[model samples]
Target: MTNYKINMGRGFKATTLLLVMSACILLSGCAGKAQTGTQGNAPAPGKGSAATNQNNTGGQPEQQKKAVSETEGLPSGVKVQKVLKDISLKNNYHKKVELLTDGGKRITITDPNGGLVLLNLEYEGTILEVSGRKVTVQLDHGGQQTMTIPDNMTIEDDDNLGLNKGVEIEWTVDADGNIQNVELDD
Candidate 1:
């Protein structure tokens, strides 16, 4: 009889310990998940985190969305301006106009408020013929162009980069379609 009582006490203690352990595990598992409150204002379905527009029902604050812009990171009072082909810049000069000729016609940027400006443009072709200061080139897409090589034009490559037939080249042009500079394309 004494052995039976001893065994029963031990079994009871083991059962109590198991129940406590199970309760602790269940509580710990539930603690990791977020819980929504039922008191205050909640957002509508598919709108935000909480339920329908019930305030005070709380969880976390809604995160603000970031705005996107193409002209982001540009200096204040600066803007990008695009110029079309065959447009003259003689009458549209800006105080801080910067020209970039990287394959299309030259572009001009003007700050209506007289601020800084940047213009991007380009043209590329293969040398077809070179006659004195005049060089004829076959446009990259599908056209023929004749540009006058300037006296001080810099060749941005080694001596092997000659204006010969089949040689690809990139150049910046002025408002009058004159070649301002040339670079050999590898």
Candidate 2:
């Protein structure tokens, strides 16, 4: 009986040691694969070129600029002429309103219920549009309002304006110089 007990103890120790060694080997293999950087050898989704891969890895790429909305781009060269508030149009009426850009060229606004709004420079304040993160404003006269600008919108030091930050417009302007009534384009 004593010999049998000793054998059992030896067998248990051998099994435990084998399990421990197997676990260590498995963990080491995983670490090696990670170090090699060849887990799948396939590029991750949305990670194509080196630049895109850097962006995917939460690393900013060289020569790549951060994207800014169109309204933010407007207030730089342009200046705000006036701020139209309590604008009682037929449809929407905004609370805190601001007209931005040099000739009131661009409109940056925040409404009570509505979200962020942006007007264009070329078009007079007649054309108003709403874009929370993005927007498309159609002028009451003619043309389309786009919230996409390639470069970063910058504001230089020039006091030909009243409002400092951005403003929120309550109403949307149509292409015909009328308040925006129709639903936004998808």
Candidate 3:
């Protein structure tokens, strides 16, 4: 009878030890997997990482200068008298860009996803004449050019740039010759 009792105690101890060992192994494996899963969701490499990969500090500034100059190129017959904004692909992101030669033109281009991307081309000019949808403007660089106003263009005359002709104004545009926005220079 005593021997049977001793055997029962040993069996219970062995089973308990085995269960504890199994549980420990399973928990460790789950913890390792959880740590690895978090890495997959980490944010993408930031701008600093890109710079580090270049291996040369001088190279970074050269790349930035090139980017700014790439967009600074002006089309034929277009002159930037007062640079309102230095636009580049690194700065502007829009479907179409308009370069306004006249003031008192109000057009707003917005991105619903927020203003993460900026597209602004502004120049100062004087209104030469307003004839229906077309307005002739004397550019700062001593040339007169006419721009057609879209019927859907919004006018915000807070500065009264659009009140009459012969007003000095600031305007914004896109890559194409379509006006995006306009306002008083002051």
Local accuracy by lDDT, each model: 0.45, 0.35, 0.45
Ranking of models by TM-score: 3, 1, 2
lDDT of 1 by residue, 55-161 (tens): 32332121110111223333343333432332212222232222222224434333222222333335678878877546787876456767776765555433355
lDDT by residue for model 2 (42-135), tens: 3443244476555456422211112224344453344344555434221121233445433333433322223443332334322143333243
Worst 10 residues of 1 by lDDT: 59-68
Q: Against the true structure, what is each candidate's TM-score?
A: 0.38, 0.20, 0.44
Candidate 1 structure lDDT: 0.45
lDDT of 3 by residue, 1-186 (tens): 011011223444576588668845654664466457667553332222344436645433323333333233344544333333332322122122333333222122322111222334555677777766566777774556677757665543444345247766555666565676444432
Q: Which ten residues in a row have the lowest lDDT in candidate 2?
A: 1-10
* Model 1: how far residue 146 lies from native, Å: 0.7
Deviation in angstroms for 168 in model 3?
2.1
